[model samples]
Target: MTATLDHTAAPLIRRPAGRPLRQLVVPYLYVLPAALFVAAFLLYPMVLTAWRSLTHFDGISDPTFAGLDNFRDLFADPHFLLSLRNTVIWTVAAVIFPVTLGLVFALAFSRVRWGGFFKTVIYLPATISAAAAGILFSFVFNYDNGILNMILRGIGLSGLASRWLFDVPTNTFAMIATYTWQQTGLNMMLFLVGLQGLPPEPIEAAKIEGCTGWNLVRRIILPMLMPYVVITTLLAIVNGFKVFDLIWVMTQGGPGRASETLAVTMYREGFILFKQGYSAAIAVVISVVALAFSYFYLRSVLEQEARQ
Candidate 1:
């Protein structure tokens, strides 16, 4: 023998260099358009906004560095406080109601025969544009001749028909209700997808072992669905903090800043008040909050998946 090693112990020969180079280059090429788009649109704006947060640009004027004055003012601003409060309220409401109701409905749909029809009907409202929904609800909640008030008066419960969109707590709750109604479809679909993907064996086994109703859900379903719950909660918080279009259309951050969230505040500061730098600061805050929550949520999801 010429002292050659066993084939299994021998190092493999490398592929031709040009072919490898071409393969590598092709993948980069495939991603080039998306990379460029993200760089130009997402990265550039984010970097610019971060820089602007330290400036004092008023849309028309040259941006001058103002150190942390804008951030300092952000803390003491009553408008900011009210907006934060409302954002917290919306976020809590979304988490407690929509997520819970969505999970309930998803389970019901999974077990029901007519789920498709019900899902379609429930999700139809979500298909409507938020702007259109706002306009429609504006009419629904109108103080004088609105549908809600009319129904209340017709039922001889006029005391409960007070201005839905014009009062403080009522306006905020009314908007939250509308948001929940519109959002139920998305939540339902997400939960349904998660439910359908679950290994049927565990559910069936649990049922066979006398685990039914809330016991099955509490012990088996909820644990598996924790990932989805975290995801939905994260989305709700981000959406709550960023709500603008519908609230703007319906209340214009009004009834005296009662319904304003961070997004509405940013819009008011940037466009209406012409405080571009300040608005950028608010934008940064929103991004920071979203990123923090997303980081934790994704980490939790990865951990859960790894365990599975």
Candidate 2:
């Protein structure tokens, strides 16, 4: 019996003498092109931008070392301060309104017969480019002959309609509303995917225990959908931080810098005003904020997923 066991185990434990050097190096060779691409396009540009931020380059002139002066000047400028504030507002509102509305729509329409039609109509806006959407909303928000104002007059609520894109806070809120309309459908689709992919056993078990309506959703459904929630919220925050095209097309960050976000400010500084260093500084700040959020949130998500 001992001889029989030894013979069987020796056959099972057979090992190769060595791997060929080419086979060992081939995996790394496969990864080399992608690594080079990232280094050239992403990492090199990031390093260059950071270096530019520390200088006084104005696109035409040679760069002169400026240290933190650009940042200091940004804090002192009222327009920059306003843009920062607007960025904060945009990030917060984007996270709240679109995400919440999307989840709500997903839940409400998941079982509806007309859900497909509703989704198509709602998601159509998201398919349009940001610039195109901005142009369309500009016409819709026209002060005089816009459809919104026309509808308001028809309903005898003309007072409610104003220069949507011309006022201070109103312009900001109008743009936010437009963003919400465009974003909500995508969020809804994500949540709907999550909902459809849910494990049915827990839901069936919950229902048998008299868990229904909001209780069932709050207790069982939501916890399972946390991944989608994290994803949409992160996307919303990043998009909010870097929003420029829509604002540029709609208002050009004006009626006097009222609706300027960080991205718009950076563009105005670098391209329009020829302040390359200052724009680079703004770019660095935006990158830092976005990276911090992504790193911490993704770490936490990984930890949670590992435990599960």
Candidate 3:
């Protein structure tokens, strides 16, 4: 009876209060604020935009449900088709030119003396705002008295000095050149950072194996740098698709809309023409395209990693 009474009086062997519960809850609590913020801002806006794409509203008027009409109209619209073509061209150019040039310069800079000075000089262009770069290039591409034309005349290549921003294809290419000049710096910096963080032991070992200069790079270095290359190329492509400010400041989708990209067309539709629903549709399309590419890229990387 005394033993039974002592057992009854003793503390209950229940799980300790608070500790395990807090361990489970505290982590979620730490993440709650960020989750709420993303839900409110990004997720909510995305859902609302998708809804808006299915409706027709003139900003102030009550939105009318239009189902898939907006998407159908988008496909039928010739201007949108042209803009898509331009977007493709820009994406291709951005991925190829800037990434390649940046890689070349980064490798060269990594091996050179006074690399910091050269890096600063090369990366300076990235500091300039897109608008400023566009404005600067406008003057550089000016027809008759422009520095580019003057240089061409000086160097006996005057035939190559046609109105850079006047023709359709030429204007688009000229704009791309301007973007490449600015974007190269960013890609170069990214590559440079990757180059700096590389494990030096492998490189040193390769040197012992008579792998010097290009041989070292082609064999040991390039494979390791593949991740950076992929990232740089992806960013360049995305930026190219989303390019607006620079193109707007430079071409304004001019030369008879030859240089118009999807972003330009979307802006013209939504703001200039006040087709809110149409614009939302365009936004959805752009988002879809970007997301599709991003998803595929990440999936590919994951698959490749898993295989390795």
Candidate 4:
């Protein structure tokens, strides 16, 4: 009887020696490849860019230490200042128009018949590449003959139609409008998702308390959709800061660089003029600005969450 008890206890006590070690290390083993990839690709490039920004490297020549000269020159250049101004305009317009229009469209679609079809139609532009949309709008805004001009002439509003991409503020606003058309659809879909996922109790209760129409939306629905609003608005701001493909394809930051944003300026300096170090400085500045925006957004979100 003692031997039988000892044998049973031995079976329970003698676990596989390697089992716990394998369990501890397996997850890290699985994650190692991705970590290595990020270090090699993402982290290494970022470090290299930062170092290069402090040196004078024109791609072909040996890099020489320049210590803030590139940044100093950047601030002094009128074109760079203009680029900064244009970037600000892009960020503001992108946020206001896309987010607002998206919310409006989402609300309208939620109420209307054939809403799904209308949504599909509106979302069609988002399926098109930014470059393609840029090219399409370039023709639409052509000086001599474009659909927009033709329609304006037909409606006796031809005076309002001018050189859309040639003027300073008009060119900037034209690009903003094009961006809005492309972006609003995605925002609408996101808001619609938020609306559909909302719990019925608050809305039902609001209705029971005689809340209706704009008041209901303003007080109850909008507050509930805060998460989606944060996401969409942040995305719009980031995209605006990074806008390059559309500007490149449409205006090529043309008419003497009047419409150049920082991204465009960076590309023209680095690739076109071969000012590698200056371009790196511009890239670093852009990254810092984008991070600042993200940080503020995250802070605001956390504050809201805490308050709730």
Candidate 5:
């Protein structure tokens, strides 16, 4: 009996020795493919762009070192400044509208029957390619023979129908509205997921304590869903900054650069004007801005999660 007990004990001791190795190896294997993809796609392009930003290539001749001249020119360019302002406006409006409407939709859907069907319909836009959506909105917002103008004329609001893409304020708002329509559904889905995951015990307790209506949402639901809100808002901001296809298809940054975003500017400079170095500089700036925003956003999320 003593010999048999010793043999079993030996295997148990050996099992513990292999556990730590298996744990470490399994996680590393799972992450290996993702790490390779990031290195190949994201990191490589970033490094190459930074290098190109310092040179004058124009995609034909050998690149010559230009130091910081490209950046200097970018800062002084009036068109670039306009693009920057447009980008900021786009980011702010995009984040605000999508997140706000998403929260509203999430709340409504969470409490209603047949909500899944409505949710699917709302999320449908997110499945459409941005280029296709842009083309669709182009017809909708066309100044002459457009659906919007036709509807306005029918409703006796013909006076309000004007060249939307030509006017700065209206054009900007029009583009932002299109983006909001597509993005709100995604935000709604995120919030819905967050809402569903919330602890029911607290919600029931709050209801029992007469925490009804706005109080229930404001104090109970919103707090629990803060993490989701932050994630979706950051995503909206990034997408807004990177907006190109819609603006490209609808306005072509046209009627006179009214709708030109950084991405559009980059495309025009690099591909259209063949100013590859200058375009690379703009691309570098965009990448930097995106990275900075992501870092801060992630940090805030981490801190919030820790506190919770």
Candidate 6:
């Protein structure tokens, strides 16, 4: 009887290994459609863009190999440099302002009565089309008849009035403000979700230990929400770098090129100026940057999760 049992167990043990392979294959089969879609839309375009970057493609003619000439031209263009600077400025300001404001709002809302209502209100902007938001804000920021300037004048702050879309500094600020307003709710939502998922014991314990108000938030809540913070920060950084529509619709890369981002630069190169190859190079650069950021962001999130 023991010998028969052992013989049966051997087959069962061996069968488990084969089952794992079948399980793995089934999951892959399920994912195959998504994988193919990504390959077709994302991977193929990326490879093609990299190839196009090495050529002089004007979209109409056969592409001629340009070697590194496009890159050389990109480096030499002062407008490109200015665009780069403006992009960096936009990214930094957008990330800082929205994320900071989001954190504050998240913390406040978490502790407040009727917080869900406010959260919904704040997040409403995120649902609006960026192009439409840009158009709306453009009217608000208009020099003569804009609501913002009108409010400023009414408040006896007329000196603050300027051509918001035409001036470099003001244009950048207006764009950043618009971006912040749109994104803050998303960030707040992320934090709110994180807050909701937190274990209640630690919070209750902290309160019993005399942790209240800001102390409770700073010492207990903030530390617990680190994962959400990292996620929101990464998202903000990526979005900031990719911002184009609002800037494009609001300023069209500006009176000069004041609010132009890398995305806008790519668009102007590819579509407006008809430098397809150059635009491809710019697109590649932006893709590479985004990939690097996402890789690190995901890695950090995973590591933090493992530690927790």
Best by TM-score: 4
Models 1 onward score TM values of: 0.90, 0.89, 0.86, 0.90, 0.86, 0.88
Instruction: Give the runs in model 3 whose Cα sits over 4 Å from its true position.
Output: 1-15, 19-37, 296-308
Model 2 agreement with the true structure over 102-156: per-residue lDDT tens digits: 9999998898999889888877888888888889899999989999999999999
lDDT of 3: 0.89
Best-to-worst order by lDDT is: 4, 2, 3, 5, 6, 1
Candidate 2 matches the true fold with a TM-score of 0.89
Worst 10 residues of 2 by lDDT: 299-308
lDDT, model 5: 0.88
Against the reference, the lDDT scores of all candidates come to 0.86, 0.91, 0.89, 0.91, 0.88, 0.87
C-alpha lDDT of residue 36 in model 3: 100
lDDT of 3 by residue, 160-263 (tens): 88888988899999999999999898999989987987889999999998999999999999998887787777777778888999999998998877789999
Better of 1 and 5 by lDDT: 5
Off by over 4 Å in 2: 1-21, 300-308
TM-score of 1: 0.90
**Across residues 108-192, which tens digit of lDDT does each residue of candidate 1 receive?**
8877898899988888888998778899999999999999999999999999988888887889888888888888888888889
Q: What is the C-alpha RMSD of each candidate to the true structure, in Å?
A: 3.4, 3.6, 3.7, 2.8, 3.9, 3.5
Steric clash pairs (candidate 5):
none
Residue range 70-126, candidate 4, lDDT tens digits: 999999999999999999999999999989999999998987999999999888899
Residue 101 local lDDT, model 1 = 78
The residue-by-residue lDDT of candidate 5 on 1-308, one tens digit each, is 99999998987777444567788799999999999999999999888889999999789999999999999999899999999999999999988898899989989988789988999888899899888888888788898988999999999999999877778778888888888888888899888988888989989999999999999999998888888888788877888888999889888897688679899999999999999999999999898888887887788678766866
